[model samples]
Target: MRRLMMTMLFLSFAVGAAACGGGAKTTGADAEGKIKITTTIGMIADITEQVGGEHVKVTALMKPGVDPHLYKASQGDVRKLEEAELILYGGLHLEGKMTDIFENMAKQKTTVAVTRDIPESQLLLVDDGSGTHDPHVWFDVKLWTRATETVQEALSKHDAAHAAEYKQNADAYIAKLRELDQYAARQIASIPEGQRVLVTAHDAFGYFGKAYGIKVMGLQGISTASEYGSKDVSTLRDYLVANKIKAVFVESSVPKKSIEAVIQGAAKQGHEVKIGGELFSDAMGPAGTPEGTYIGMVRHNVDTIVKALK
Candidate 1:
C-alpha cells in the first residue's frame, strides 16, 4: 500500500513539473573565486551563510512554508546541484520524497547531510511497529546546535583557507543556540503541567515535546503523506477532552483543515478548544519575519506555545 501511494505521489509531481515549463535552469556563478553552496531549505542556507560568512554564496531550493517532504526539484535545482562546491541538507529523511535525488547527488558532489552526523542514540524513532528515524531534529535546540557544528566542520574542511572564520562563526552560533535552549525551557516551564499539552496538525513536534515537558499530540504521523485515520482523530479528541486542552495549533506548511478537524472533534466531545497561532513546523516564516532564521524560528515557536498554553 505504501509503495503504491509513493509511486502515485511521484507521478503527480512529475506531471506538475512538466506542466510548469519543465524546470528552471540553474544560473552559474558570475564570480570566479566565490564558493557556491546549495542547501535544501532556507534554515540550512542561513546557517551555512553564518559559517561561510562572506566567502561563500548560498542558495536554498525550498522557500518559506514549503514542505520539504512534498518539494519537487526543478531543472534549475538540478543545475544548482551540479554547480555547487558544497551541498547541505537535513538528513533522516526529512526530504522524504527527495531522498533518492539527494542520495544520487552524494556521489557527484561534496554533499553533506547535516543531520546525519548526529549520533543515533540521541535521535527519536517514529516507529508504528515499523521503525523509522524522525527527521525533525531541528525542533530540539541542543540537537540543532550539534547539527550546526557538523555543517561548520564540513564547510571548514572544504574551504581550508577560511577554516578559522568558519569555526569562530560556528562557536558563536552554538552559544546562541544554547541561549535559545535555556529560554525555551524557561518559557515552557511557565505553562501549568496539565495545560502543557501541545496539539498540532502533524507529528513534527515530537522532539519539541521531548525537549521540554509538554505532551505532544498530532493528527498525522511523521510524513505529511501519512493519512489521518479516524482512530487517530478519536484518540486525540479523547485526550483533549480528558485533559481539557484549550488550544491546538496549525502548521504554516500544512493545510489548516486537519487542525480544524481536531478542534471540531474536541467540540463534539463537549470540550472547548481554540486554534492557537499557526506555528512554523516543516517550514520557516517569510524571509523578513522574526521566524525567518533558525534561531528566530525556534524562539517564535517557544513563544507561541508558551503564550497559548500558559
Candidate 2:
C-alpha cells in the first residue's frame, strides 16, 4: 500500500511536470553558475558538496536523523528532483521507497547512484534469501571513497567545464577518508578483542564491524523497516549475557526504545548493558554540527564505540 501511494504520487508529479512543460527544465547551473545538484541523503549531499566545492549548489532531500529505508518522497521533493540539473543517491535500495521516483527521474535528467561503481563482491548479502546487498556502504570508509569518485565523475561529466576542479577536490576528500578509515581501524583495535562486540538497535553497522574487526549484532535487521518482536529482544539479551558484552549503541535515526528494552532485558538476566553512545546510522547529525559531515560522523562513531567497548 505504501508503494502504491508512492507510485501514485510519482504519477501525479510526472503529469504535473509534463503539464508545466517539463517543469521549466534547466541543467548545468542556475543564475549563479553553480551546478544545481540534489541528493537523496545527507551523506551523499556532504560528499557532493565536498567534491563539487564552489562549483555546485547541493540540496539534500532527507535531513539529519531521517531513516531512508521508509522515506517517501513528497510533491515538494518531486519539484526538487525536477529542478536539479543532476541528481545523486545511494543505490542498492538505500532509499527503498523512492527507487521508482529516481528511476523515472533518471529518464528526464542526469541521475546517478553514488554506489554504482562499488564492486559487488565487496557488498554483503542480507542473508534473507532476497539476494539484496546491504546499503550502508558509508560505514566502511574505503568503500565510500568509491562513492566519492562516483560523485566526482558524475559532476565532471555533467559539467565538463569544472572537471579539473572536481577531480582535485575529490582527490583531497578521498585522502581524508583514507585517514578516517585508518583512524577507525586503530580505534576499534583498542577494544579488548573478546569485548569487541558491537550491539545496536539495528544491523546498520555490519560494514563498520567488517571494516574494524568487531562483531556486530543488532536487535533489528539490516533495514529498520523490518519489525522486531519480544522474541528478538530476548534473543539479543541471551547473546549479551552469554558473551558478557558490556555495551550496545543506539542509532540517531532509530528509536532508543528498542535499545532501552534490550538494556532492561539484560539487567533482568543479571548482565547490565548500557547504551555506549548514539551512533549515526541512517542519518548524520544536524547541519552545522561536527557529526553532520560524513568524516566527522565516522570519527564520532568510532570514538564512541571504542570508549564504550574498551
Candidate 3:
C-alpha cells in the first residue's frame, strides 16, 4: 500500500510539472505555420505585413505615439524578439537607445535593418560629427520605397517559398509610394516658389525638403536632445518677418511649446505666423486611422503643408 501511494504521488507531481512547463513562452513558427516576425516600429511592421502577406505574423514593439529615440525594451519585448524568426528595425541608429540590444540579438537570431542596403551617397549626414546617416528615411516617399524593398527582400530570403508573392506585394506597394511622391510634388508646386518653406519644431524634415522641393528650417537639430538656442530662435523670427513666411508646423511626437514660442517671438517682431496643421514626425497615426498607414500619413502631411503654404 505504501509503494502504491508513493507511485501515485509521483504521478501527481509529474502531471503538475508538465502542466507548469507547458506555459513556457515560444516564438517563431507556431503550429499554425506562420513565420513569426517582430519589428521595432510600426512603419517596419506595416511594410513587413504588406509584403509578407499570408506568410508572416508581425508584432511592433513601439506603438503610435511612442518615441523610438528613447524607447527601452521591456522584458516582454525581449521575449517577443527572442521568439521571432526574423526581427526588423530601422537602421542608422533610429532606435538609438536600443542599439546594444539589437547588436546582441543579431548573433543569435536573423535580425535585419530595414535601411541597411540604402547607398551612403543617398543618405543625409548628421553634420554634428556623429558620422551617422539619418534614420528618418520614411519621411520621403521615394526614399521609403527602398525601405519597403529591403523588407520584402528580407522576408523573401527567410521564406523563399513565398518569394514571388512577396515580390508581387512589394511591387504594388512601391507603385502606391510612387503615386504618393508625385502627389507631394504636385501639391508643393502649388505653393508660390518663394513661400515654399517648411518650418517645424525640429529638424526632422531634411529628407522631406530634399525630396519635395521645399526649404526646411527647424528650431532644433536632428536629434531632440540637441539644444534649442535662444539666439537661433530670435534669428528665425527675424527671418520669418523678412521673408513674410505665414505658417509654421508642429510635430505629433514633439512638444508644441517650442513652436508656440517661435510664433510668439514672431508676433513680438510684428510677423503673424499661424500654426499650420500638425505633421507626423517620428511616428505615424493611430491604428485603424487613415494616417496610421504609411501612404496615408505621407498624403496627410503633403496636403497639410500645401494647404498652409500655398
The best candidate in terms of lDDT: 2
Give each model a TM-score: 0.89, 0.91, 0.91
Error (Å) of candidate 1 at residue 140 is: 0.7
Which candidate would rank higher by lDDT, 1 or 3? Answer: 3
Candidate 3 residue-wise lDDT, 217-289, digit = tens: 9998887767887887897888888999999999988889988888999898888999989998888899999
lDDT string for model 2 (1-310, tens) is: 9999999999999999789896555655787988898999899999999999998899999999899998999998998888898999999999999999999998999899999999999999997999999999999999999999999999889888889999999999899999999999999998899999999999998899898899999999999999999999999999999999998989999989988998999898798888889999999999999999999999999999999988
In model 2, the runs with Cα more than 4 Å from the true position are 1-28
**Residue 288 in model 1: lDDT:** 84
Model 1 regions lying over 4 Å from their true place: 1-32
Looking at candidate 2, what is the lDDT of residue 291? 98
Per-residue CA lDDT of model 1 for 191-234, tens digit only, reads 99979889998999999999987898889999898898788888
Global Cα lDDT for candidate 2: 0.92
TM-score, cand. 2 vs. native: 0.91
Whole-model lDDT, candidate 1? 0.87
**Model 3 error, position 30 (Å):** 3.5
